[model samples]
Target: MSDPATNPPPAEGEERTSDASSTDETVAVVQAQEDEPNFTPITKDFGFLPIPKHLRHDPKHPAYFGLLLNATFGFAGTFVLANLYYCQPLLIQFSHTFNVSYDTVSRIPTLVQVGYAVGLLLISTLGDLVRRRPLIIMLVFICASLSIGLSFTTNFAVFQALCFLIGVFTVVPQILLPLAADLAPPERRATALSIVLSGLLLGILLARVLAGVIAQFVSWRVVYYLAFSVQYVVCVWLYLVLPDYPAKNKGATYFGLLWGMAKFAVTEPQLVQAVLISIPSAACYTNFWVTLTFLLGGPPYNYSTLVIGLFGLVGMVGVGLAPPLGRLIDSLVPWFASVIACVAYILTHVIMVGADGINVAAVVIVCIGIDVFRQMVQVSLTTAVFSLDPAARSRMNAIILISLFIGQIMGTAVGSEVYTQHGWRPAAALNLAWSGLMLFVVLARGPHVSRYTWVGWEGGLEVRKSKVTAQKRRDEEAGASDIQQRGDEKHALEAKQSVREEKDLQDATTVGMQEVKISETSEGEKQGEDQPPMVEVATLSAE
Candidate 1:
């Protein structure tokens, strides 16, 4: 190519030179600017927003930030939920201690579930209205008191009632979950959420194990006392350290706040889908753990409560794998990885259904598989819901969580019935069926993007833009219609004023004309009368 920059060589070459010249000059300007300490654009005036000194975050200790949140909020909140289940391993012992039937003692856990469901809705809604930190502190103390009361109670009715109340306050875990996600940077959000959720699973598993050990050695009542003590200490620590954000539902009335969340949910389809998909999945996972203990304790292996509790130790493998899976979530396409994780969950159920005898190796492997899948899917679902609306994340969480609670209830009922009617194999088989159905739904429906998309996950910011093509056309038509309506109103007002002015001018003109005519006629009559009287007087003198 001839150097066309020096001279416009040919017609085609001239066009090429014109296009390339601006690009070359812009590159030169950028290079020149790089040499200077700070350079201004000098083109269309644009300035960067000022960076605040205090707003900056330290990136080095990202994991440490989440660990602090988990230790304070996760540890205490889960301790309460864990305590609800501490009665699980000791339910038989508790029934004997109180001289109650196994059926009557089972109501304790059911009461806790009802209380938990109510608490999640009540405390979460209030937390949306007020500061979360204070409520979390209060909830923990109240729950601790209930646990203490449960420890001292000899009365079955009173104990069951307090157990329900403990469930009501156990929602501190729900509050902690969203807070962890809020506190974490974008890349770390899934990891942070997973870590906190792992605490939830850990509490469920360890509560049984710890209770079994305590009941075996000390006494079942001592388990509640120990949990109550831990909760009180954690309540104090969390009140001191947990960060508070501005209320999500500020200035909204009780009914109005709930209605607003409902409105947003109906308008947003992705939220609806995420919650729907989570229901079956959560049900299956919860049923697996609850039923597993009962099966192991009853069968040919006939394990003790402590031996059954040790099975939960294998769940540590699932928690350990969370960070790696969270990292992979970023690397892979979301729906693809989600589908894979769901498959793992479905397969684990297959392994569990086939488990018989002591089968220690098979059971551990199955539990690990199930836990890993549970953590991964949960992380993905949270990502999807939070991705939909950054501003309304708390409410979105509340809506999805209601489904999880409902799922828990269903799971508990199914596990109890299946174990009683059809043995461990059939019960585990039913869980597998639940997982398979959920997997099929996920694959068939696929991942969805909303009309509104969020950006800046790391910094927790959202910039709304119109995505649907018809939106611009609709906006233009609305603007034009508004202008036309205003114009028509202005013209109608002007026409009415013009008619009034015309009528007033006509009345004034008519009055002036009548006065002039009257004056002229009077002058003419006086002249005529004077002339005739003068003529008559002259004729009389002549006579």
Candidate 2:
């Protein structure tokens, strides 16, 4: 005999029993599977190529973000953003090549900026809705194709259209910034963002130098051809190395996401503050760069295109300072950084106003100061906003960048016009005015002491306390409800047990009465059987 727990084979007439037992076991297994919830991962493996085990990204896995991935993001962001500024130094060349006036050719950069803003609004938002690796690859490929069109086009209209398209698709940097923030550790997120931003700054500065040098010796068209090659290379690099990021907003519709962005702009005070500060900062930055071309190329300077482009090298100091500023933002409150940047912006513009393009030293100082301070402000604001909501980084980034590019468009259009019509002093003064407005807004709304009656610090504190109190009340209410429910459940269980006991007692009493009646009937039957034969015999004799 086998052990009963082993479920030994059925005996010769127990086939039905064996089959029924097996059927029950199968149903139990299936039911158990059905009870478990389905789970899907937020990050996916890179299927396009055989990515190394150490480079893969998964929240559960140990393949953490490291230096190599950071460098890859930096390089990819650099070249993709370089497409935007290549045409800046080539504006004069475009004028001659397309046989258009300088004023007409100047609109090309503005159109590019407008297209960039449109892309930030429409395309970059999709980063949250789709896998970022594929989206980024597609954008880079299209941008490379656009570069080819730009390289060969002679018609100004076609050239302008291609430039716009180039700007539209060159939003990979915007997408990468948020991706970097997502991948980096919490303590180092700001530093990671700054690394990518540093590359972008380098691209903006170096594209001018690269375009000017290539166009000076060779043709301006070569610049675009080179851009085309560099883009393709970056595309391949991204395909091989970039880890996959699954969609964050999986079930959301496109229009709904846009609407959500509008809501964020209005509802999130930190985001609103960042946007307001970034707009004027961006405007001033673009204003100075756009007008500097005119100021350097005319009057006392008469700088050639190459000479003008070389000035971008002076701004590299800002790129070098970005990482440290990011670390600073991580360690301290971002408000201090913003205040410092605003002060620097105001002072830089004041000096530019006084120098009036006659002092080369002053221009270089302005370049370094603006670039460094702009990085400070940008890194600080980005750290603040990204910290507000981790899930909405792409959309939040889109909002801030859309505003920034709008400011760029304004600066490019208005700065060129102002500098061309008036002199350097007026253009510098306009930048000064923007800086002043930025500082005023930062101080008024930022975390600072002000005599203004509308500061609302006390009100803000009260609102925070009220929110805390309300949350505590809700928790207490929930706890009370749970306790009441448990008590009700306990009372219901006791009532059910009492009813069952009463039912059992009634059944036991009825069984006892029936047993008693049966016993009595049996006794009567026995007595009658003992006396019945004699009575029947007497009746027969009498008859």
Candidate 3:
């Protein structure tokens, strides 16, 4: 995530920046990075510590057990919503099987996107207000059942409706992502969040590949059946194994919480920027995959669904490379990682736009680059959102997710229309435009971290620490440091001893007083001055 110019140069023949006609301001910035010493993150020491031994092995640590749970949940989430993507490359086959038009099969994916939009708005919104564990578990089970039911239906209409329902429940993974963030230690938060997000990225890419392979070997229905089984097991595991996260908005009603989230999101400039920037980047990422299938399936090569699926494995290489890139970013200069991620995304989409008609090998390379850039950007955004409000992490995440959902809908819609009218190039162009806009937001806004001001109880702790350190330094200068330390320690020890001695003395004093009272009562000494009076009173009562 180092600045692009600070990035290590390629071997001699690679294309470096060509800035003949560009504005002087941008050219100067680019040139400045190149002219400066090759400073990478390796020189910086601001990174988080490595994972600790106890946490590394502990099942309770989210990275260990939580990773598997999150990934399993991810598989199910993808199983539910990702199947909407199945008919993209396989539309021709689906058309033949269902005796429907190719365009009609296209509606299935579109409807799924619509369903996803609804889920993000409703289910994901509700996810933050309640106990996340039970809600996620319920969604997973419901989505799984629906997917399983999908395998049995021969009707396309039923299939589309089921896909929509699956989208509705697929918000569970999105819900759990913030939970993973919540569960992770602060130092390791980004890395853990990335691990869960990796599951999401893989699910998105792999669903296409897995579906293609299954459709080639067996019927498309078999794909849903497999998803249903995997999801059911994962759902059961999630219910049993995943712990419930208490809602942080404890005092607020559900409607109040939702209203607060909305109000805060719109008012916060950083959150607003996040939504605006993500809308397009997500659109690009979504559009690429959605359109790629159609282009590949209808061309000179006429690749089968399975072969198109194989290309998804290319994305795996990028996924593997991303963490290292992130590690590098984290190691870099303060406040530069996010900038690097954003810049990389912009360039990557530019490359993607021009990659059409390029050789398959070259296109694969570009796709991998795109994948790496996208993943890095996502990691940066995830880190940025959680940083905004650790307590409100879920709602903040929900906002970003909701934006991405909207982005998905727009991207899918535009890709569909553009592909129908112009071609893949137009879709790619649209994606690049969005990437450019994201870059503009990045440059204009600096980094999202800049706007964050520490608040709440921890902010009080920070203030106290600052004051304590300052007082200590002032005392040292005044020649009272040693004297104060001696007095503080002595006073603390004396307070402890005083408390113990007081308790012991009180116990002994109470015992002595009780013995004296008991002796007096036994002897009937209380009526000693009035012995004749007590005898006369008893006789009168008897008479």
Best by lDDT: 2
For the record, the alpha-carbon RMSD of candidate 3 to the native fold, in angstroms, is: 18.5
Error of 1 at 107 (Å): 0.7
Per-residue error (Å), model 1, residue 266 = 4.4
The TM-score measured for candidate 1 stands at 0.67
User: Runs in model 1 with CA error above 4 Å?
Assistant: 1-66, 264-267, 294-305, 330-333, 353-359, 415-425, 451-543
Q: Between prediction 2 and prediction 3, which has the larger TM-score?
A: 2
Q: Which runs in model 3 stand beyond 4 Å of their true positions?
A: 1-100, 293-306, 325-335, 353-355, 413-430, 448-543
* Each model's lDDT: 0.68, 0.77, 0.64
Candidate with maximal TM-score = 2
Give the clashing pairs for model 2. Answer: none
TM-score rank order = 2, 1, 3
The order of the candidates by lDDT, greatest first, is 2, 1, 3
lDDT of 1 at 26: 14
Better of 1 and 2 by lDDT: 2
* Local distance difference test, candidate 1: 0.68
Per-residue lDDT tens digits for candidate 2, residues 1-543, read 111222333443333222211222112222343354763333333445454443343333322346677778888888889988898878888998889899999899878877887899999999877778778988999999999999998788999999898888889999999888776655566677888899999898778788878888999999989999999999988877787655676578989989999999888777877888888888889889878888888888899866887888988898888777777765555666677778988999999999957888899999999998888888878976786665688999999998897788778778878888887899899999998988876666644223233333432322222243355467878999999999999999999999999999999999999999999999999998888688789999999
TM-score of each: 0.67, 0.72, 0.66
